[model samples]
Target chain A: MIEKILLLTVAVLLSGCVNLHVHFPDAADKTAGGEVPTRPADAGGAAK
Target chain B: MLLRTAVLLLLLAPLAGSAAQITLSLGSLRHPSFEAEGVMLSFDAARLGEADIRLGVLRVAGTEYRALKIHCSGFYFDGRRLDCPEGSVRREDERGRDRPALPFSLAWRAEDNFLSFSMHDVDAVAFSPLVKRLRSWQPKGTIDFGLTVEGDRAWLGLAVRDLEFASREGDVSGKAILLTVAAGAEHRGGAWQWNARLDWSQGELYRAPWRREAGVIMEAAGSLSETTLQVGLVRLDVMGTGSVNASLAWDRARGEATEWGFVTERLDLASAMDEWVQPWLGTLDFPKWYAAGHARFSAEWKAGGLRRFYAGLEDARVADGTGYVELGGVNAQIPWEASSPTDAEISVAAGRLGDLPLGGFALPLRLDGSEATVKGLSAPMLDGRFVIDLLRLAKRPSGWHGEFEGGIEGVSMPKLSRALKLPIMAGSLTARVPRIAYEDDVLRLDGALAIEVFDGGIIVHQLRLMDPFGKERRFIAEVTARNLDLGMLTRTFAFGSIEGRFDADLHDLEMQNWQPLRFDARIASSEGDYPRSLSIGALKDITALGETGQPKALERVPERSGFSFGYDRIGLSCALRNGVCLLDGVAREGEGVVLMRGSGIPSVSIIGYNRHIDWEALVARFREVIAGRPGAIIE
Candidate 1:
């Protein structure tokens, strides 16, 4: 039973390693859905 | 006969006692060289009274003097001679308080037909009729002279003071002239042979591009006839400078010099250039120069054209004020003829062009008419040699044109870059140029130049330069770089390192005054690349170059193993126009472009959303990246 438990732990660790691919939201979809963040204007700016 | 008549008239006038008045009139009085018409003489008393003599016309030599009047006081005659110890001369037509009478003393010896006269404070305007060139200049001066004439010979000792004259254009002028002259003349064979010595002790004279200041003495001998004036020899001694010997033949009718020549002793180059050469160089587009040396020059001119010229220099050093050109230990002997070819040589110990230093060289030159040629000329450059197989230059009616074939061999790139103030680079540069031609202020390459640098080859085609030395200089060319190692380029420019090979194509590139104006440039990874990878620093730089703001995707990478990443391909393109660059990447990924694509584990890709960017802003960002500043985030 301890050998089987060790096998299951090894499998879980391998699965975690395999699922490590990074995921980023599509930039175009974010812009289309009005979810893109806008940077704030700096204070104390000189007038043109 | 005329002198005898004048003596008889003076004797009869004095015979009339102190209280007696006498008047005499004659139709005309004539001599071989002197004549007078409508002559009259009148006197009252013999001691204190005045004698007035008026003549409608007085002709001396070949010039006519009209309305001449001579008024005499204390006149006396001794039967065979006449003397007027106090006399004054005037012109009837002159009407101004400033026109004062000229004082004179005269004695005539009837025995030998000899005349002696001395005049004081004679205005130079009185002789303007004889010197046609002075009529428009409005000469103002006073002259004092003593003249003695016997038969066909004459002698004059003259002194001029406070002379001032100028032309309307102000190109020819003189001021504060104090001149002393001793001249002698004799008439023979219907012409006058004359010689004079002139000393200009204090004055300033300007004749167009030539100027003269005080302390000049000239001794000249010439013959003047009806049709020509020939100066046999003229020796000029200028203060602080050497002498010059010259001669000229001038045509009186055409008012031009038919032939002229001059030979100068070795002159001090510094003084000569300042006083004479600089003024004449105003029309040429050349920088101001300072020189030190001694040189001798000779030239012949005929029919208003140069016929032959010769110049020799010794131990010369010349440098421009702007530090663009300099030469030292220069010695040369150059001779040129208008109709025949001549060979010459120049040797230089050292020189510099821009910032590049040059070693010593001796070059042979050939000149004929308006053309010059140089064959097999070689000069030492920075750790290399520049060889010119042949060069030919000719002066055309439009301007100057030339052609040359040359090559640069084994020049160290690092040294060249340092000299040019560019980034330090590795390897050596070499180029072979087939031919370059220049015409109409434009220089163009007839064939492409293949240059080896950065372990690759760059072929430059359609290269042209316009007004290379002028303010509006321009350069145009197209270049193709093949298999350039990216590591070396990035290291040279201080860009983050990437291990790969790339090829670049730059088409229709143009620059004005060394600033880029337009170009279409594309850089892509070379085919069959090896070990293609980018470091973390390089990845951040690439991201900053393309994206407006930092992407959250970069933060997702595990920090433990974030040293480098493998890349499948890299590509970037920029088309510059109107101060804006239209940018692109390798391929489309949804609505963005893939700047870099990952190929292995722990790899990452960059996507660019913006397509158009300000060129100046882009360059600023690039500078910030190269300086290792934090990546800029813009919206």
Candidate 2:
């Protein structure tokens, strides 16, 4: 049981180590660590 | 026999002089007259069919008498013939002061070596407003006969420099400073050499109506023909503040079907160059060359509805917080080809709004259609699709409809307070509306808005609004601000800060008599639910209300959620646009019912003050405040 608990802890630690690879259009990559703004598809509201 | 020979020699001597000999070089030229070393110089005499000059060149300090002023008849063409000394010039200085010669007529002269002519009383143009403004005017300058060759195939070239004159209206009172003018020209031909060229002291005029200073460069070139004349290249920096790079070309054919075409690099529905140059359109017949910077094409012209006014604008950056009506700058871009008024298409890119000093703001706009009409007035409506807190309308209209798309980052509550010209809770917002409509000058937005306020600031995550005008009165929205620093909002508007949180909305607001009236808004600052020195200072700039308490140990206390909010005296007031707001009532304190009704735009004044209320019972009172009515009191 103690070994199992140790394995679970290691798995949790490794999960945070997972690197996320993201690609974006040139315009969206203007700055690092920032989200690009996007316009609404139409003037209609979401409910419509 | 000797006497008869002498008479015959004298008679035959004059006949040998038609050899087009070199004449005296005229020294200098002044108004009404100039001196020629050889024959008398005059444009008036030349106009009488064919002018003739009789003189000789002062070569080696000698005059052989070879040039002839044959009149092909008149001898000495007096200055009166050319109306030189007697010629009166018109003035371009005053508005309706009865000064006629604004665009003076061109004058000229001819001689053996040098000839000169002068043009005075040239009209100086003035733009609109207090600054220098002038009507239509022709550039005024002089032409000098630099080097004149006479071999029937003679060539005439004038240095054409240092030609000084005014191109702007002269103020009668002041030493009418005119548009500084300087230019030069040259021409060569046999029977008739047509030559004229003009250049400016400045490079070019590219400024908008909102811009203070402007400059422009214009050039026109063409050979004179008895019939079927051709129009050369001409350009007008239409916006006075934008680019006038279009290419307009046309050709004249003989064997048949009159062919003409035009093209452009970037075509706008309402052309900036065309509008500026249209005044001169009637003066000269030119095939519309809308595209001056790019392309090669041409089309026929036709007339349509409301040619002049194509777009209606609502610019409000000038008077932040003033309900819609007080527009700062107005511009209308009509759907007309740069060169041709008919049979052409124009496109509108984006326009910036906030740059006007009166209401400085930046708004980049894009137009969708080539044509749009407001109340039957057709104009090139700009496809506006930009984010808010960026730009604004220039003209405050009775009604409006617009849609633009752009992004505004990092807009804070304090800035919004200053822009809206009012007080509010602190927060930041990043918002965009697909469309915004204003009818009767009331703003109606049809879109969605998402916001997050952290650290005493209103933050916008995403906001979209637009109104197409359909069922479901849609809704005019306003956010409720709580626990905000009223001081920040006031200072941004240059009105100083007040202390309070505003839980109020103008409720689909608009201007009535230039005043923005709020039907309901319940506000209560911990330190002031009533009239405080801060509120009074913000409104009337008076520091005679409420106490100025000294800072307590809690002054350094960090913002804590548990220490969230505390109630104080409640107060309300009627808002006025631009500036001014009437108190809804006298400063009221404690637990009291604030009655509101549709009474003459609603009035406010403090009635009484109360203290010590049961915590459980006060919840109902809070609901009452939202309803703008006296709530149930179990005091």
Candidate 3:
């Protein structure tokens, strides 16, 4: 059991960790009511 | 059949009638003999001479008695050989008349007695030693297997003492050849009695990887259906001296159908000890030894530190020394709900008892069900209950809290004290309907309540109190069931403890918050739930209310120095925040009257029975309020 714990510690110290998530805002606004708004996805040319 | 009976009677009557020849059990008698019961014989003479020895029935198969190529010779108890056989069967005076007849096959020479040896099919391991001593070859070459008979009247038995057999199977000692094999009767429909016992001890053998120092004993006797039981205890030898003893007894019918659906199945490998390394061999785990009628049943098992209460699958798992619990996820059908292991969750139920800790104590918990994952953590879902120390509160203050929830169900609120071996508290109240929840600083509830306050405690029936974080702010309640003893209730509070009772509506009453600013409540203990169906003032004042028409204590204990309350029962819908209370547009001074004007004093007062205050109209005003809204104005 102690061996397993030691191995886990070694693995953690050797590598790095990651965070949960990051956020960004969208293009829609009340002032732009009814207007066709461009999106980041469209600018990347993936829109069909 | 008639021919066989006549032959058997003819052959056995002579030996049976002779007192010198005795028939013994299969396990007795070391050598072969004629009077032997079934097939067991003992040679006990000491001389060099030939005696005509009678041989028992030697049959290759039923109805087929075959003459055995017998081997008769003499040997001392020290395993020394004396002059006996030049060859196997007897030869005609050296004339080669019996080249293969086993010289003196039926004739005893010297001290050895003539023994029978029939050439019937025999297991190689059993006779390999004898064949090797004779320098016999393998395959078709083998020793005597005695005879083979077919009948339930008798059984085949063999006994050999101080027998060792293991040829040089490649440079290894006879110890390596040690193995266990058994040859017992497979009776068709009869009982077999056995007093078999075996002991395995550690201090008695060679060195090995696993130290197995233990003893086992077993005895059994029964028919094909019913079996008598026998058991034994053994010590586990680990670390040279550690040991664990065990014992069991069972006597029942073994079959396909029984009461409660009992069936046999393999025990879970995950639960088997010696399968995984345990943490803290003796302290934290509680392992169990269980016996059940069939598979798919629940059993409480503790291993070291872990424990679980589980609803066993038909076969998978059962009692986990801890317990199998889930909050709102899967076991929603269970009467008591447990929200999976949270840093915290709250509940408001009818039970006077809330988990273990009454109010805000530490509670460590685990959750289990079909959907077990505790959400984001990669750790395995806690499958059983774990302890949470209330003392750990300092560490996870905001993350863990147990707020009582739901209706108290069939829980008698009166025995809440007796049942828990707690301080005596009495009263039993029921709710028409109720529900409550607590978590992350919030507790919400709704329901009707009829309770009794007898002796000195309060009993509630329909009740609801919600404390949802700081958002909902405070809680307000109203109950109207049966008996309620106000003095007993003060003891129920975990606070420093306060005690008293009144006959009027108690507007602000609270438990579990920081301040004494209680929740607004509109409650009337009429149907004998309360001692006096009271809420307004104590007996000291009640006397004044009926006589001088005023709160008698109003003239006694001054009200918080600068504030005084003259009204015994007042509207509760007025301004209420934190601790400060307001009545109509006016405020109060410590005495029992409203301050039509202001006092230079800063702190508000909580008036109790006291002098230095008006006592007449205060009692009359109480009468007016009772005639009007009686038990109105609640949150």
Candidate 4:
């Protein structure tokens, strides 16, 4: 009886999760095409 | 005819000489509608009555125009046209800073009152004098611009292909900005009316001030008429994830009163927070949390501050870096205006809070003054619902204060254990709380919550949290459990089988950074008429209880080989303070405490000799025993 109830609750919870999606992808993947142009020396204080 | 030509040539000789010399000086030179001072013109005469003209330094409106050289092939006035065939202007300010020369030709037709100058490859470096007055702004790179004036109307156009701007002590920079502006203005009735179009493209604002480069593009059109400036429309794109459309109008005659509105659609929350929010919250410490959603924002301002604001969110999700707290399907519509009342409903569909699965909760909220009232909400918990009554929250000068009343009814304990990542236990858990309040960064509960498990009742009281959101969180509580079946607790933890009832109390219990701070706790066998049985495994572990002893304290105990015993009672206690546990038991004989007292056949008793033990080491021993990794016992 306990196992049945546990299975039922799990089913309900899983069914409600149809819309859930992992929103954060890898940062490196999102920035893939090298969009930022190289800063000139006058742009100042580039990271060493 | 011969007599007439001789007479005309003689009369024109001196006038031709003066035109060839072309020298003039005036303390004040006045045109029909304009005036100037200290004007001087000089040039060299040519044999055929042409000249090379030089206009010297002159002062007008506090700005000085330096010498200008021009070559005039023909310098005579004809039908209101004074034309210069070829010329070049050396741009300079009063301080004599030289810029590159722009070669051009000029013509002025006074009959139509139009002046047109055409030049090729002009540089805007001469505008540095005007840009120097702005704070923390510098323009670097080349710009090409042009100007044309016709009567009282003027037209100016400028464009720059790439430029770099930096701020924040040179740590923040933006590059490769394509900018263009075209404007036309006409002066009439002592006021100017103008319209302009501005375009910016392929721009990226970069580095330290931001964690990464943020790309941007914008296009806008605006007009200025009389004392009112109107912005027709502005379209902006950010990070390829969102777009904004906005418009504004400001009345300068009325203390710059402004009305503006904007709509930003479908902005990725993670990038938005990283680009626009985190830099301002540099002092706060929190785990890396990611979010995604669409948020619509609008606001109105007058008299230099906010008058009304609204925000709407849809399909929003926020999660911590550790994957512990994730929420989905968050939606809300909130509106606030000065001294006005508003109400909203926030809902979440399904997600996990810490380790507990949470779903289908809606909170109805009403705000007035600086206080908000939450009119209860229910969330699914295991097989039941956790319900909260009306909660009140008020913002004060220090932080935020809030209070609520809630309880859980018949939540499945075994599943809850799994959610809480705890040892599995039987039965169910239920709780009732009269009140919980938060103020000055502390959360306090005045009443007790009861958990029904192990066929027992555990009551918790005086629960409090200090710095609940800080790096080091603390939980303080006192608890008492009565008539607990020891067999259930032992079996749940797999700590060997024991059949009996017991009672326990924990007083002044405090946990800081998730470790015990100070507590006086005791557990003893309860008085009952029930069969008391202990397995050999239980006897061995119990016999190992000593201040510094390992889990397998007595390796060769009498009941080591699958033997069982019947015990009359057992008791243990510890006064944990200052990182140490002062050990005690039901009785003390000699220098040791008798932890267990045996009564019948195969009876066994255990004694602990040491009194003071490191709390952490003692906990490690308990964990090892439960993990079935008890080390060798001492002789």
TM-score of each: 0.71, 0.32, 0.21, 0.65
Cα lDDT of model 4 by residue, B1-635, tens digit: 22332344345446654435545442443322234454433444344424454445444323455454444554543335546655555434444234444455566676666666554444444344333422254546556665666778877777776666676477777687667777777766654456666666556656664644335556666665547777768777766467877777878567464777777776766667666656654534433566778777777766666677777778888676556678899898888776688897688888786677886788788877678888767888778777787689898887688998887778887787777757765567677678999987788998787777788878888999886655566889988888898888777776778888888888778998568887777777876688777776765555443333333323433445455667787787776666556666667767767666766655556666556555665567567667743322211
Which candidate achieves the best DockQ against the true structure?
Answer: 1
| TM-score of candidate 3 on Cα atoms, chains taken together | 0.21
Taking every candidate in turn, the Cα RMSD to the unseen true structure, in Å, is: 9.8, 21.8, 27.6, 16.3
lDDT of 3 by residue, B1-635 (tens): 22342344345544533334332223211222222213322332333222222234332211222222223454211121123332243222333333334332222222333232243323333332222232222222222323222232223333222222323342211121112212233334444322222322212222221222223222222222235332233222223222323333334434221211111133332332332222222232223322221122122222222122223222222222222212221111111113333232222111111232222212222243211212211111111112221111111344433433223333454444444444444444333233343445444444434444544233332233443322234544432222334445433432112232322233334533323343333322223221222212332233333323443333343333223222222111122233222222122334332212212122112222222112223434344433423222211
Report the CAPRI category for model 3: incorrect
Give the per-residue Cα lDDT of candidate 3 at B584.
24
Give the docking tier of candidate 1. Answer: incorrect
- The docking category that best describes candidate 4 is incorrect
Distance from true location, Cα of B98 in model 3, Å: 99
lDDT (10s digit) by residue, model 2, range B1-635 = 22332344345444333443322223322321122234333323223323333333222112122222222322222232221222322222355245332221222333322333333432232111111233333333333332232322223333323222333443122111223322232333411223333333332232331111224444434332322323344443323334332222232234222322222223342333345443244234321322222222223332322122222222211222212222233332323333333222322322233321123223234222332222111111112122342223332343343333334444565554444434343555544544444444344445544444422333221222222222212233443444454545444333433444433333233323323322223344333243232332222221111112222322333333322122233344332222222223223334432311111111112221111112122333223322322221111
Each prediction's number of clashing residue pairs: 0, 112, 110, 1
Model 4, span A1-48: residue lDDT tens: 999999998865443221101111112331334331121111111110
lDDT of each: 0.73, 0.30, 0.28, 0.63
